[model samples]
Structure formats: C-alpha cells, structure tokens
Target: MPEPLTIMAVHAHPDDEAIGTGGILARYADEGVRTILVTCTGGELGEIADPSMATPETLGEVRERELRRACTILDVAHLELLGYRDSGMAGAEANQDPRSFAAADLDSAAGRLVELVRRHRPRVLVTYDDDGFYGHPDHIKANRITVRAFASAGDSSAYPDQGLEPWAPDKLYYTAISRSAMATFAERLSAHGINPPMSNEDGDVPPFGTPDELVTTTIDVGSAVERKRQSLWAHATQMGSNVFFARLPPPLFNELFGRESFQLVESRVATSLPEDDLLAGLRGVPGGQRHSPAR
Candidate 1:
C-alpha cells in the first residue's frame, strides 16, 4: 500500500496549535492526511483562567489534558511533547529554568525533534518563524528547533547517533499572520468593544505578526472553523468560555479565523506563490490544486 500523506507541525505550547494551525490540521485530517502535532513545552506558565480549576503546580498537567482534547477535536493523528516547560516571556524569571524550552540547549532540543521527523517521515513540516509569532521565548525556541530539524532530519551526517534513517520532507512552512489580517482582527475586536488580546502572556505587546508583503500562501480554512473554535475552547484557561473570541458572531469568527496564512520558508518541491493549499505541489495535489474555500 502507498504511504499515507503526512504533515507535521511543531508548536511552543498546548494552545498554539489551536490558534494558528487548527484549521489546517482539521482540514487535512478530514482529507485523510495524517496530522501530527509536536508540542515542545508543557505550558506550565500559561495563566489559569479560573483558579478553582488548577494551581500553579498543576497547570501543566491540566493543559496537557486540554491539549489532548483539542487534538482529538482537530483529528490530529499523533501528539508528541518534548517535555520542556513553558519558558514564560522574554526576560522573565521562568526563562532561568533549565527545563524551560528556551533555556534548553539548541542541539539537544532540536535533536529530539529530528528523531520525530525521521520516525514520522512526514512529507511536509510546519512551525513558527524566528519571532515565534509574537516574540514569545518558547515560540522562538520552537522556531529554532524546527528549523534545525528541517535541515538535519534529511541529512544522515546529522544526528546519526539516533539510529534512524534520515528522511527529508518536501516543504517547510512558517505559520504567519499578515499585517492586514491582524489589523482586520483588531478592528473586529474594537467593534465588539473588546481589547485586542495581543499581549504576550504578562509581557508587553511587542510589535507582533508578519508584514503583509512577506506572506506567500493563504489557506482558507472556513470549512474547519467550528472545529478550530472548539479546539480553542478546549484551552479555556487561556481563552475564557465566553471570552472575546468565543463571543464573536459566526460571520465575524469566520471572517477572522476562516483563513490561515503561511510563508514558504524553504521547499524541496515547487509551488506557485500565494498558494491556496499547503499540500499543493506534492505528489497527490498535482501542481498544488487549490483546496482553499471559494471566496
């Protein structure tokens, strides 16, 4: 039998998958593509929306439960964790923890990801950019490790000690939010009399998101928005039950969360710019037939 088409995403925390990549994960899984999520941190630093639900010491485990449920909702086939704690925000005291993803040695952290790459032999790999989507320390570290694994997983000369054959994925993409999209989301939030929740945990909201011109692909995930919202709801500790996001009307929710953008950082396969499908240009898609929803 032919190998099932596979795509893998590496994220910094439990809820990260739901926010940026949830639609793709759900959409691809619906198409019978194997979806894998590698969560690098335990999300121990995430705020507990309700104190009665968990304490400081137990937040990580609670978030894991949430992560599992979110994955099920998205139909992610595999969920892997590198077992590092959330490396709070930049310059925070949590950054000092040796087990925090940001503080872990790059080679060491990335080696763990390389092993997964070789094991899964996914055709496509995805992660955040060097900015970690909003300058989160753990996000940045996830980017660093993902970039490393993407480069080394296909090279036998790298990480040979792992005893797995090297496997190269055809494409590497960075999840991104175009400046225009961010502006639209902000406008919608204002219309609802809600503040833009761009703050990085307890840290100041640094200049966030990607420039519009830099975005190379936009996947319309309108079909999967319901799953995406439910997955986000699974992380209710970070996003409240009737929070600003959940409170948005369906049209607005679809307008804001209906699409996901990506930057084609590197690719072993060819594809047209402004692609509508992440699986475009791969063997099955035949020159990347557009899978994005019709506008």
Candidate 2:
C-alpha cells in the first residue's frame, strides 16, 4: 500500500486549532490522511471563559486537556506542542516575557518545527498568513516561525544538527477568512439584531479577512460541520455559551463554517483555483515533487 498522505497544521495556541482548521482536519482525517497538529503554546495567558475554571494557576493544564479532547474529536493522528508560554495580546506585558512564544528567537523556534516537518514528511502544511490572521503577538510569531520552517525543512544545510534528513512539503497554505464569507456572516448577525463582530462603529469592515479575489481555495466541509462544532465545544474554558460560535443556531453555524478557505502560499505542483482539495495536483505524483520552498 502507498504511504498515507499527511498534513501538518501549525497553530499558535490550544483552541486555535479547533477554531481555524477543525473542519479541514476532521474532513481530511476521515478521508484517511494523517493529520498532525503542532500547537506553539499551552495558552497560559488565555482568558478563562468558564466561571468555574477561574483558577489561572491551572489554566495551562486545563487548556492542555481541552486540546487533547479536541484532537480526538478531530481525529488528529499526531499532536505536538512546542512548549512555549502564551504571549497574551499584542501590547500586553506577557509579550515581554522571554519564555513567551512571541519573544522566542525566530531561527530557534523554526528549527524545532523543522524537526517535526522532517519527521512527519507531510505532503501539505497549513499555517497563518503574514499578519497572523488577526495580529495577536503569539499568532504573528507562529506565522514567522512556520514560514521559516517550511523553507528550512527542505534545505539540507539549514539545520544539520537536528539529525533528520531534509523533507520538503509539497504545498503550504495560509488559513484565510474570505471577505464574501465575512459579509454574509455580518448580514446574518444584523438580521438577528446582534452586533456583528467584524464591523466597527463607522460600519466599515475591519482588517480581518482576505479579499474575495485573493482566496485561492475553498474546502466544503459541510459533512464535517458537526465534528468541527464538537471540537470547538471541547475547549470549554476558551469558548463560553455566550460567544458568537456557541450562540449560532446549528443550521446557521453550519452555513457559516461548513466551508473553510485557504490561500495557497506555496505549491510544488501546478493546480488551478478555486480549489476544493488542499492536496490538489500532488495526489498521484510519486513521492511528490518539490518546488522552491517559500522564502
């Protein structure tokens, strides 16, 4: 039998995996692809949304358990934690902590990810865009290191001391929320008399989503929507009952999140958009081909 296809998703915190990529992870895992999740931190600085779980001292441990439950719900084949502290929000004091993910050395952090890439030898890798989706410091740092690791993992000279042979991924994608999807969700929220989260007081859209024209791929995960919802609910301390995701009716939630979007940042194989499969043209290629890694 051929080796099973693999996909690695690098995320900034525990619950981020469920929020941003749970559908794709669940869908692909169900289709027999090996799904690996690399969480960059333990979410030590995350707010405890559950009133019962208000002990900050144990939040990291609590979140870790939540992450594990989420992985099971998503059927993730492997889970790795980079073991850094959460950096909190952009301008917060946690950003200054040397042990925080946002304050770690770029090359050093990338090196750790490179080791995972070499070991897993995934055909595709997923991570955040340059702005880190919403610009939280830890998210931005995760993007930097993931982008760097994508390139370095294929270069034999980059980290020879890591003791693994270089292995390049066939494709790299950035998780994206398309403007059209955002607009639809905003309209739905307004119809329900709830203030849309993406709109400002002036009614201008926030700098949160990618332009519709720039979205290269849209994966329809309608079949996996329930699994995705279950994964999200697993992070109880991070997502309370009043949050937008939890408040949405099941039908509406499926309508909004049933499809996921991605920007194909780097690809070794030729493929056209708007693509439905993240693997695209690389599925039948023996051992897959490597294009120049993203710089």
Candidate 3:
C-alpha cells in the first residue's frame, strides 16, 4: 500500500468540522488516511440545543466533550484548539471580547497554525469560502488565517523556532454547498413532511463562473453517512442525539445528500471546475500524485 495521506481541516469551532466535512472525514479515516482537525475556539458562546443539559454554566464544557466524541467517531488522528474564544456573530458583544477569536493575535496565531502545517505536512488543506460558508465573521477570520498561514508555513524564515521544518500544502479548497443541493434537500425533506425554513425567495446562488460562485467539486460520501451522523451527535450541546438529522432514516439521507461540496480555490496544478472528485486537481504535483488527503 502507498503511504498514508495527511489532511488538516481548519475551522472556527468544534462542530463546524463535522457539519462541513464530517462525512468526507469519516471516509478518509476508514480508508486509513491521516486526518486532523484544528479548531480555532472553545465555542463559549454556543447555545444549547439539548434541553437536558441546558445550563448556562455547563454548556461550554459539555460542547467540548461533545466535540471530542464526534472526533472519536470520525477517527480523527489528531486535534488541536487555537485557544481563541468564540467571536459569536458579527455584531454580538462577544465579538468585542478581548479573548474573542476576532481579537486574536494575528501573527502569533498564524505562526501557531503554520507550525502545525510544518509538523503534519498535509498535501491538501480545506477551509470555508470567501463568504466563510454563510458569512460568519469568525469563519471568515479562520479562512484568512488559514490562507495566510499556508503562505508562511513552508517558509523556513517565518517561524524557525516553532518546531519542524518548512512544508507547503499543494492544494487548498473552499467548502461549498450550492443552491441546487439545497433545493434538492428541501424536496427530500418535503417528502418527509419537513418544510424548509428558507425558500428560493431567499436568493438563489448562481453558477460558478457566472458571477455568484458556487462549488465545482462534488465529493460523494454516501458510504460514510453513519460516521458523519455519529460525529454530528458528538456535538451534543449544539446538536442533540434526537435532532432532526438523527431522526431521519440514514438510507434516505444518503441518497438525497450523497455528496459533500467544495470549490477549488487555489492549486498550483491544473484543474477544472464542476469536477466529480476533490482529489481530481491534486494529482500530478511536485511529488507523487495523490488525491484529496482526508476530509
């Protein structure tokens, strides 16, 4: 067998990883790929969806535990928190907190992430799009830091004292979910008597090259739907065991939501849009050809 591929997923909070790429991550781990999740905050500002554990004082710790459980389910090889506090939403008071993610020390934070990149040496990195996968301020910041860190991670002169030698990732992708997917999901949910909260009147997302860019790559994770469910269940404080997703039949979900989505943001190698696989653009790089490392 070939050497195990390494993957690092950077996100602003605990459940974000699983929600965004849990199924893909599960598939990667099942195939023996080395996957890591780097969360930027403790999610102190998160709300509790589980009424049983609904205590203001206990939610943060509970969510942390839940994140660990999810990680275990996904078979993540490594996990790290950037140690920043959740910034909450854009105008929230949490955004002004000195310890909030938005207020994090940029250079130092970048160095920390860069250190991880040097240590893991993943070939592919995944993060949110320019809109930050729904325009969350913290998510946007995470994307900015990840992009910046990727640039400096491989430069020996950037942070030599941090640890391992320099190593740059070969490709970077933006996690994307298109309007078509949402419409299809809405139809699926309707079949089960679940009307979507949002409608097409909310504003349809345009195709990739037409102006409003959507995803081009569709990564199928139908086989790993159960793993993704378990991972999502791990975020108990945010999503309880009896949530809407958990209540659904796995088979139905797998058919309707068979694939995870993403946009090819930047790649040194040649690639095309509307591709069927995330690993498609990753082949034929400086070293041996490899597909998308992990989720």
Candidate 4:
C-alpha cells in the first residue's frame, strides 16, 4: 500500500469530530489514510443526555474518556486537544467564564493550531462552515482561529516560536449540512416517532447545505459504517440514544453517500463545483490522486 494521505480535522469539542466527519475518518483509515482529530476542548460543559451518565459531577471526565474511545473507534492516527474550555452554547453561562472557549485567547489558541500544521503537514484541512455548523460560539471561534492559523502558519513571520517551518494546506473545506439532508432526516424522524429539535423549525438552515453548486464528494464507507456507529457512540454524553444518527438508515445511507460531505472553501487545486470527490479537485497533484477513501 502507498503511504496514507495525511488529513487533519479540527473540531471545537470531542463529539464534534464524530458528529461532523466520523464516517469520513473511518473510510479514510480503512483506505490506509492517516487521519488525525484535533479537538480544541474536552467539552467539559456538554450536556449529558445519557441517563446512565447524567451525574453532573462525572460528566466532564466521562465525556473526555468517551472522546478518546471515539477516536480509537475512528482509527485516528493521532489525537491532540488544544485544552480550551467549552464555550457552551450561544448564551450559556459557561460562555461567561474567563477561561471558556468564547473567552479563549485567539492569538494563543491559534498558535497551538499553527504548531499542529507545522508538525503534521496535512494537505487538506477540515472544519465547520462559517456558521460554525449551527453558529455555536465555540464552533465559530474554532472556525475563525483555524482559518486565521491556516493563513498565517505558512508565513515565517507569524508565530515563529510555534516552530517556523510553514506547511500550507492546499485546501480548506467547510463540512456542510444540506437542505436535502434535512428533508431526508425529517422523514426518518417521523418514521421513528421522534420530534426534531425545536431550534431547527425556523428553516434557518446554513448556506453551505445547498451551495449554488456543490462539489459533491462521496465516500462509500459501506464497511466503515459500523466504525462510524462506534465512533458516534463514543460521544455517549451528547448522543445518548444516538437519535440524530438513528434518523439515517445505516449502511444504506453509507452505500448512498457514506460519511462525509464538504465544500471547497479555499483551494489552489480546483475551482469548479459538484466535485465527485474531495481529491477530485486536487487530482493533478500526485498525492492528490482521485481515490475514494471511504468503504
């Protein structure tokens, strides 16, 4: 087998990684691609919907352990946490904490990410869309800092102490949720007798979902769907009964579109939309050969 392509996913919290690209990660790993999960925080303030782990006292620690287990399930080649506090949701009290993610030192936070980029030298970088996948403050913050880091890390003048060797990621993607996906998911919810979250009623879906033209990158993680399930399960505190995923008819969904979808936000490779695969845009580059990394 050829050397696995290196990919890095930066997420605001432990569960975000699995929630956003668990399937993609599994698919890549199965194809011998080296995948790394960069979690910014332990998600110390996350909700514990799991009745079994509902105790307020143990939730943080439990969630942290769960994140590690999820990384294991995803076959992550490496896992690093930037050690910030969860900013909680939009207006939660946690956001008020001086050390909370919302209050995290942007320069310092970004410097940590710069170090990772310098070390891993990933060709592609992944993060939530500008809305931060739902405009969660922490998610937005992560997106902001990561984008800034991506732009600056490649410059020797920026944060030289973080290890000046610059490695510019060729492409940056925003993991998007589409209206079609929402419609499909709603149908699934009805079948399962589960009500959708109240916040979703406004139809205020983010723009990344249905791009004027989406470069569709499909990963057939048919075999890795089970791994995806375990990876999601690892975020037990957030997933609980796995309600969000239960909406999707597994393996079938995997066979259909698999675990990942991304829109090229910044790329030196390809400019056209509706890309069949992520690497499709980068096909001209030797390491960027068009190979479906998922199942």
Best by the lDDT measure: 2
Which pairs of residues clash in candidate 4, taking residues 3 or more apart in a chain or in different chains?
214-274, 215-274, 215-275
lDDT (10s digit) by residue, model 4, range 242-263: 5555455565445434546677
Query: What lDDT does candidate 4 reach at residue 269?
Result: 65
Every model's TM-score: 0.91, 0.94, 0.84, 0.84
The CA lDDT at 124 in model 3 is 70
RMSD of 4: 5.7
| Pairs that collide, model 3 | none
* Sort by lDDT, top down from the best: 2, 1, 3, 4
Q: lDDT value for candidate 4? A: 0.72
Q: How well is each residue in 31-148 modelled by candidate 2, as lDDT tens digits?
A: 9899999999999987788669858889999999999999999999999999999999999998999999999999999999999999988888999889998889888988898888
TM-score ranking, best first:
2, 1, 3, 4
Clashes of each: 2, 0, 0, 3
- Against the true structure, whose TM-score is highest? 2
> What number of backbone clashes does candidate 3 have, counting pairs of residues 3 or more apart or in separate chains?
0
- Per-residue lDDT over 155-211 for candidate 3, one digit per residue giving the tens place of the 0 to 100 score: 667787886767777678778777666666676777786544433454332332112
Model 2 scores worst on lDDT over the 10 consecutive residues at 286-295
Write down the TM-score for model 2.
Answer: 0.94
Candidate 2 residues lying further than 4 Å off, grouped into runs, are: 201-204, 288-295
